[model samples]
Target chain A: MATVASNQRGTGSRLKTWWTILKISLEERFVYRGDFALGTLMRFLPIITQVFLWYAIFAASGKEKIEAYTANGVVAYYMLTMISRAFSSMPGLCSGIALQVRDGEIKKYLIQPIDLLGFLLLTRIAHKLCYYVIALIPFTFVFFLCRGFFENGWPEASVLCAYFLSLIMGFLLGFFMEASLGLVSFWFLEVTSLAFVYNLLNFFLSGHMFPLDLLPDWAAQFINLLPFQYLAYYPAAIFQGTIEPNQVWQGMALEACWLMAFIMIARIMLNRGIHRYSGFGG
Target chain B: MTGYRPSYLNVFLTFARNSLVRDMSFRANFILQCISTISWTVMNIGFYLIVFQYTDSIGKETGWGRNEFFVFLATTWIINSLVQTFFMPNAQQFSELIRSGNLDFALLKPIDTQFVISFPRVDWAALSNLFVGFTLLCYSLYQLTTKAENPLIIDWRSILMYPFYIGCGTVIMYSVMITLAATSVWLGRNQTLYNFWFYITNFSRYPMEIYKVGWGMALWVFFTFIIPVLLVVNIPARIMARPLNTMNSQMWQLAGFAILATVACLMISRRIFVRALKSYRSASS
Candidate 1:
């Protein structure tokens, strides 16, 4: 029997692997610099229309408020949404693996004695983190433009620090959820369509384009019941200082529970997935 | 650019028919995709309308009403969709073909390779997106423009300019895509760049004026001369209505710009595509 490295799941080892994966992914992305930059530039288009619509809404309203939000608040909230996405966790990498495996390439991965999930999570997270780091330039530029319209909003250091921690936890939960979706590809060959539905559901629930608070009361409550809020709104609300600090622990507790649950699901899936593992060996 | 004589219309028919037949082979997938696209389009448009319904007018401009904005958004998007259907996919696929040493097979085929490669695939489902876009445009136009409501006839100039602008728009889009895909020759593959292109399809939905003056001018120049996205919808509509004096001159300059860009880029990209094909040393023995 081979040595299976029982203690390899320690945080330090995982961190080192994550760092290496990030470096490798960053190198891969560096080759497509122009495309990445252009994509960053292209992303501004929808926001442009959004800003225009807000300008119109302001014009139409004759200085009115919808619920608790003023026109400026709505714009700020959306801008915050964009910023949140730049930092939000990525979708699962299993979608790519699903395709890679179907093409019979996953066999190469099986020979490695190291933890596969660690490598998968590390590399995918690295690419997104780096992509967002590059993406931050534009996100900050827009935020600066947007900040001019808002009231004073640089939060206190302690609250801000708490928000930052919550943000990281939020990202981890979101990553775990999406990565689990990718892991599902071990069984399903065409997860693309499923991914579409998954992302669309997330787009609405995660409060990406609109604040969940803006949804009808019932809809808002329904979405809150799901885990998507921890993906975006929890962190965004903290940054906006709209959410209270006492609530932070509640949110974090929920995030921890879901993270634990999803990690178990992933472990189960990985184990079961190996039994039916064809490794493109059909 | 020497070539054996080939019937232009026949080439198109063959390509069109082949794509149609191939797509028909997976009839249910095509229908499902159509339904998916329709729902997706409605969701997007609904999101805009929700925002619009809550607002008085965009830009705080007196004349730029909500319906007009929707009309503007929808019309341009439809034309953009048509261009996407025609050009964007092929450009993306062509880049892939080059990367895989697959372009060599196309060059071997007894046809004008460009004609064959450009229209060899079809997604008729996108046609539903076009219909939705057109219907939304018409509905919004009726709400905004009194002339349309009164059944007053369109001026010859406006009618003529509509198709003319579409032609210019196609040329502009084709030029941008052709060049972007042409990067495949140097970059090994540009599928990542392809991701950038589709995401920007939302840009032309708003009038260029919403951007501050300097940026607006920059957009006019870039979209007009380079990407030529404006000719797809905005500038043409601007010409039709004589919305702004500056816009009228822009439409003409844009058309001329598109023609020049198309000829120049097509020559360069084709040569590069050919060169890349020659560069390929297959991994297989």
Candidate 2:
């Protein structure tokens, strides 16, 4: 009975620690309200180019649909991609981790009782929450302006739930994937080039540039086999109702699997990296 | 007062040599960056190849057929490579200079501050894009010439005008970038400089003809008449690839406008830079 009481107390203190981290992170993000608002608005500006570019392509093709996507549908796909990317895109996470490792700042994680991954995860959650609070207005305005593109309107509640789930999983997957890459700085001191290469690959393979279905059947199949699609394409596709309700569940399951795999990989890398690390100089 | 003048050409050459040495110091990193850039270019080409499978041209009656569009793409790379190599690194560092209080040293320099700020770092890796652009341009031009369908006639005039307009494009872009960098002095830390640059330049990457309809027309007019980024790549690429007879008188007028705009932009940007310098408060203060 006494051991059980002690375990409960330990869990309570750990939760308190995470709460503090989240609060601090939220405060940090909120401090740059104007920059955040401007940055968020600037991100949507590229969609204008996308709209025109796709309109031209569709007009030139003289097709009602290209690869099962109408002109509106294609534009909608890109807009949805912006949503998924907002959740999944951890802009500086990789570089931040690499800098920490290189500067021996990871020493704090070792000395402290808090788990590094948990602390980072909570911080990212705070970041996303703060981002949504600032970006909600711009997002609503843009979506309203582009409502015509979303001809399908909204999916049923079940699919919407799955879509939200996939986005959450994508967030976890992105964090873990980038964390793993950054932890490679333990073995390879400079990861800037590697990070660049990863970003380039992610931009393409994740179907951010164009839909994966636009590729040849074999190429599409091959890319679909990879986990990068779950980061951006899968969630967007789920929202678009391109994946059937049954397939949506399957895709979510696959995303969850990928997220679990990445989490494991990140954990292993962190353990090994800490083993290799030496905290020298104050 | 003793009359003393520094040779601008000599100063530029020294800067270039120093940058080359610095780039060479990290040979592996430099080579990796070059390879990465080339790989991205290759992927972009691959993307367009897939797009062309669905359509014969980029737009209805726009005349940006596959070969013609490829020429335009190559021109973009060439212009972008020149800007990135000569100016982008320095422009990116402008805010850092302010933040670190290093602008005072730049102010102390005897050379023109803008020239010094713009030319101190040349990214040698970016020249690889120039190489790839030229190769693609040559290949696409050959394909257009050899094609049985209304082959492109490239004459001495085009050969002369293409490089001239490319230089004009580079200058216009440099002016825009330097003006943006100058904002760093007032903003204190213009972290959004690159994002803003990318947003503006994104308009220039595509064929300007695409923007001639509906709401896009407003953007077209704004970019073409006000900022004139639309004229940067469009005029040079059109001169090189688009048949002369098919070109409207408006395009030729726009070509003339591009040259004038380049000079105007440079003078205006220099004025802005000087004004921004006056507003600069050193970090020490």
Candidate 3:
């Protein structure tokens, strides 16, 4: 009974530390309030261009539905994509990690009581929370203006639940995948070009440019098999209720599996990287 | 003031040569950057290839068919590559200079401050995009001319206008970037420069006609008249490809607007940079 109580106390203290870290991160971001707001709002500008591009395409086609998407349906897909991207995107996460590794700043975490991965993940959580809080206003404004484009209106409650789940999984998967890449900095002195290459692949494969369904059958099939689809395409598809109710479970399972795989990869890389790490200049 | 002033062209050439030496010092990194940039362009092409599969034209009424659209894409790559090569590195480095008090050294130099800040470095890897874009433009033009339908007449006037328009586009983009960089003086870190840059120029990547409807009409007016980004790519691409049904008068008007926009943007950005410099207290201060 005493041991159980002690274990509970340890877990409680750890949670408190994480909470404090999150709060401090949030407050730090709050200092840059104007940047936060403007940055969030500016992200919507590209969506405006995308909407215009899609409108022109749909108007040209003169089809109510092409590739299982009405004009409104396509716009909704993009809007939902923006939302999913907000969740999945980790701006500067990889580069920050790589820099820390390269500059020997990773040594501080090793000597300190803090777990580097846990601390980084918590900070990211705080960052995302802060981002959504400030960004929710602009997001609401944009989505409200685009309300008419959602031809199906609000999706069913169950689909919304799955959509949210997929987004969360996507966030985790993206984080771990990039974290693994950052750990490669233990080997490569400069990961900037590699990171850029990674971003290029992520941008295309994650369906930021267009719906993956629009791709040729074999290409789409190949992309679907990759974990990249979960990052943007799958979650948007879920929000649009384009994924069948029966298939949603399978999709979520795949998302979870990808998340687990990435987590393992990140852990293994960090473990191996630490053994090879030699601290840089004093 | 000294009676003798250094020639700006000679100073610029020296900066360019020094940057080349610096880049080549890290040969593997240089090669990697080139590879990374080329891979991105190829991926972008693949994306458009997929999009074009769905529709015969971007806008059926506008006649920006696949080949014409490719010309526009290539033009974007070319102009963007030039801006990225000549100006983007310097603009990005401006913030770092501010943070590290390196701007003091730059200010101490005996030359035009803007010229010194704007041409200190060249991203040679980005030149690959120029080469790729030129090839793509040639191929797309070939396809357009061979078509049995109304083909673009390659006149000396348009041909001469194209490079001028491209130059104008580069100047306009550089102005926008420098203006953004200048904000670091007052804003301290100005980390959102790239984000804002991406947002502003996103309008330039597509045909300007797409921005002619509903809320997009507002963007068309704003980016065209206010910010003048729509003029950057459109004027050059339209002049070069002569996409079907676009009038020569419209082309001339756009060309005229682009030239005016370039001058206006440069003046405004220069004013902003000077104002921002006045506000600078130095990193120590």
> In model 1, what lDDT does residue A191 have?
75
User: Whose lDDT is higher: candidate 1's or candidate 3's?
Assistant: 3
Which model scores highest in TM-score?
2
Model 3 deviation from the true structure expressed as Cα RMSD, one decimal place: 2.5
Most DockQ-accurate candidate? 2
Candidate 2's residue-wise lDDT over A1-282, tens digit each?
A: 998998899898988888999999999999989878878888988888888888899999999999879999999999999888998999888899999999989999999887888888899999999999999988998899889999999988998899998998888899999989988999988999999999999999999989888999999988887889988999999889888887777777777788889999999999998999998998
Candidate 2 local distance difference test against the native: 0.91
lDDT of 1 by residue, A1-282 (tens): 133554554556757766776788878866766667667766666765566556556655677776556767767777766656655657446477667656766666677645666677677667776777777777677677768656547878977897778777776676677767777777876777767767777776788857677666787777776888877777777776666778777767877888898888877876777667775334
* lDDT of every predicted structure (CA atoms): 0.67, 0.91, 0.86
* lDDT agreement of model 1 with the native: 0.67
Per-residue lDDT, model 3, residue B178, is: 93
- The DockQ for candidate 3, computed on C-alphas, is 0.72
The superposed Cα distance between candidate 2 and the true structure at residue A26, in angstroms, equals 0.9
The better-scoring model by TM-score among 1 and 2 is 2
Backbone clashes, each candidate: 8, 0, 0
Give the per-residue lDDT of model 3 (tens digit) for B1-285.
Answer: 669798999998998999899999999888888888888898888988877877888876886889989999999999999998999888988998898888998888888888899998989989999998999999999998888877776777778888999999989998899999999998787777888898899999999888888777888888888988889989888878874245667667777888999999999999999998888777855
lDDT of 2 at B22: 94
Q: In DockQ, how does model 1 score against the reference complex?
A: 0.38
The docking category that best describes candidate 1 is acceptable
